[model samples]
Target: MSTTAPRQATTPTSTGWSLGDIAVRRVDEIELPRQTGPWLLPDATKEVLDEASWLRPDFADADVPRLASHGFAVTAGGLRIVVDTGIGNGKTRANPAWHGLDTDFLARLAAAGFPPESVDLVITTHLHTDHVGWNTRLAGEDWVPTFSDARYLTSRTEWDHWAAADLDEARRQMFRDSVHPVRDAGQYDRVDVPEQGREVAPGVFLVPAPGHTPGQVAVELRGSDRRALITGDSIHHPVQLSHPHVHSCVDLDPAQAVRTRARLLDTLADTDTLLLGTHFPRPTAGTVRRENGRYRLLAEHGSEIAATAA
Candidate 1:
């Protein structure tokens, strides 16, 4: 395990997961650095009325779901796969939003009964600070791949864009400190999920839901009676579910991001599919349903009730 023992379950409001008909507990949260930058997106200027009406928050004490965030260890294709690694400790960054700080990602992974070496495959839905923070861990003078025995999977296109030297410092360093070490170790496998959507494991497949980033993907997991998606960043801040026009200023292609978000929102709406979002109020999983023309997030089980009770 990453470390022994588990931290206290600080936050109580979290969703749950059951895969292969086996219930799994949330691995708890880790304290990672985040930028409570501007309350809302700068490009998206709004007032109190807009903030309240729109699913936005004021720049107050924005405590992103630390304990709320969870990592699910599931049995897929006869392999124990760890979908995403939350923020890791001892990572250095420049932005005040993300700087020098340590998180209990490994400890939480351990808390969830997984050793760093236990993960057979580590699938990165996308390349973002928090999403890939634990890809490499600080070891002595240099960073080392977090999971020594696991094959780290990332899209070939994503690896290229961030690794480019001409990109901004934040983007460059994210690739250097967080991603390159895994590549350097030769443990990295550039999975070019062109069109057919390669099935990394029996029921766990990578759906090419690009746009937020060039090669970003939404992971699809289907078992006997259940199916779900690990959405990387296709939708951040659940408000987008209802207001698809609200694109994060950082989006590589805001228009394309909008199109992709719309398509995904439609695809999962009113279905029994659960969405494990990277930033959706933790346990980070939910279901999407259409009301009038927009959608809202419902707890995984809540959706089941709504579906059957209807």
Candidate 2:
């Protein structure tokens, strides 16, 4: 048995893994406040989390599941892609933790060798506030596309759903600042993602993963030797692997979310596919294993950059 202790949290740096020809890095934004777990995943009570002993200290701090907001920068087939931009710096968000903050996200991205200007594509797994916040940044008086040279890609179904929904003031503000700017600049490209999935770039495909939102899709990366799936919000934490039915508080369709998660886990279990979670904390990437008829992650640690002064 491997007796490896969970990796401790350190200052955000250029941490990543290499999948044959594909190189992926986790660019740190900010670790969410401790309150996020209970609020976002109310069903994952302390008792439930305690059951997954492996989750302690790393993925979860005792009973509270630990989560961080970050982006995965991928270099594949000569394309520099960013998967799900985290909450951007200086944004007015309804959630207090996400509102009007400052972080060195861009600098971290550059450290990972993915500067904004050099980014070829921005893959938005869904149109949620957090996922798209970095889609644009405040430029003088107006929000502008952060990745000036990149094309923003998201599922056509995701864009259409938000287009028709009666959004709250905060959500509208998110769209106005983060989403619309990219579209207005002709940088947003909506792709039709069928049930089987759609390839947006070489070795990069968008797999249908709905229910958290109407058209949430998981990004799939296939390398010469390994395949990895980026779970947008479908699997918020490793605890969910132990409790597949545990649903998010904001899931648009909780039942469908469960179905989606179950199917995804079933397919991933005992397979070599690496699961890179969008919100997972340190040691963010892992492999899914069947445990007692449920699932659990066997974390895959990658190379890390030394923590620098903030």
Candidate 3:
């Protein structure tokens, strides 16, 4: 079988949002196969998606919701932070679409001006296979931490839950190669986040965002002029904004996920804070508004800062 990666579908322009002194850039990884939406969020049916016309052209195609895997690179307070790592270049994954793939993820990151070694912190919104895959890279026969100088952070609750769960071989392999290597290198730290949230860096906070995962936390980037929230799978797609009850197929607690989504939308409704979804496709940042007693994203594209080649 051929082992070449498919040509990247996204344009090479760098898209980023400005938060006063802070800059948040989108590092393209791979636009997920169209099947990802149906498989991951089965409840977001075509009929349901049709209700939100604003979702078309950008967030979703005609019938199916489009999703992409990427990370948010933030430069704030003299600290460089990455919100979540996308599926790594080469890793064994149970999901056929995510397994043993090769892509120029690091090159894209560098083009956006965040070389791995230059990153100061990597905030893993939660410990999921795709979110944590780039935490390590192959070193001879073993995996090693990708960010040698950076400290990895996750909620203490998230770590402890996964630590005790009976992980399958795929999950175990993920930790063995990606998650554990960072910890083994003494570069991993778990923070305790309360109801309000915990500030990891200047103006960056980790707010309690449970239900998706017991320990899931949404990142809040508060700036002097405006604020943005980095949703860590708490809100997977734009359809969820319209129908907050539409839950992901893998949600640990569907009911709680609904509640969390409701609370998050309520907080962001008719506000200036930009909502950045961890799995949202292109034009990934937007503002929330209450429309006809429901929520919808007013899509926002960032200013182009640099050019890259796929």
Candidate 4:
């Protein structure tokens, strides 16, 4: 794979990108400025952000930095796979902003032409509150699988970790509502990928990218000539592209997170593999490049092609 020239920075709409035969689309749930607390990233100080000037306007403002929580709808191998469901509606949440959300998430998905039932599989990169909230929905007095016909795929390590974790009530409540219901419905599949990568679907694979969560994995898509990696919280913001060592506060293992981030950035730098950040603001997809002996992201417009040959 080869590198591509940077394209003019364009605003990221709810548009999708085509990777040869596969189509990847973004199903937006929420996009807001990054919370002004160390709860997200303690190292993301104004001084640190000031150095990454590219993050302004779209990612970080003078007052508030932006972060997005959305899901990707991957259509490949004749399958409709929904990766990482965002926070669902009408559920109790510890965070005030996430509680009782009434957004038209399902409506937006349908508007994007992907109804819940039409989804063949739902892959949770990790079992986090925001990532797995849409796995179930409030139905009458109990929660039920939102994608009634889709099979749920979660890493075995993630499943076991949450299952046996000594979590607080709030986190336990999240599992009871979002994950348990799917497991009870017999639709949940525990994927035990012992190696770094494993083919989960035709031309699509799961690459182990742990640290954000014990079992966090990045979804890789290989089309006829192009490839893309859906980075699931491995690198939350573009700022990490410049400073891979600055880990998020929520990272389960800070040191390991740093290692994972550095490895991924080094491996993909100056390569054709498109990097699709799960929490990055507008123009969320890009390719890594080395500049001034450091790494940066060359943001890509959906229609832009790789400048170099594979």
Q: How accurate is candidate 2 locally (lDDT)?
A: 0.88
Q: Go through the candidates in order and give the C-alpha RMSD of each one to the true structure.
A: 6.9, 5.4, 3.0, 7.1
- What does candidate 3's lDDT look like per residue over 249-299, in tens digits? 888888988999999999999999999988898799899999898999999
Model 2, 1-310: lDDT tens digits are 1122222235647888777888788988877777788878888888998888989778888668888899999888889999999888789887877777677888888877777899999999999988998898888999999999999999999999999999999999999999999999999999999999998888999999999998999999999889999999999989999998988988999999999999999999999999999999888989999988779999998887433212
Q: Per-residue lDDT of 152-182 in model 4, one digit per residue for the tens? A: 9988998888888899988988989999999
| Clashing residue pairs found in predicted model 2 | none
Task: Give lDDT per model, in order.
Answer: 0.63, 0.88, 0.87, 0.80
Model 2 spans with C-alpha error above 4 angstroms: 1-12, 305-310
| True lDDT of residue 308, candidate 1 | 7
TM-score for each predicted model, relative to the true structure: 0.80, 0.94, 0.95, 0.91
| Predicted candidate 1 versus true structure: per-residue lDDT over 203-250, tens digit per residue | 888888777788888778887777887777787656567667867656
> Which ranges in model 4 have alpha carbons more than 4 Å from their true place?
1-14, 36-38, 303-310
Stretches of model 1 off by over 4 angstroms after superposition = 1-15, 21-72, 301-310
Question: Candidate 4's error at 151, in angstroms?
Answer: 0.8
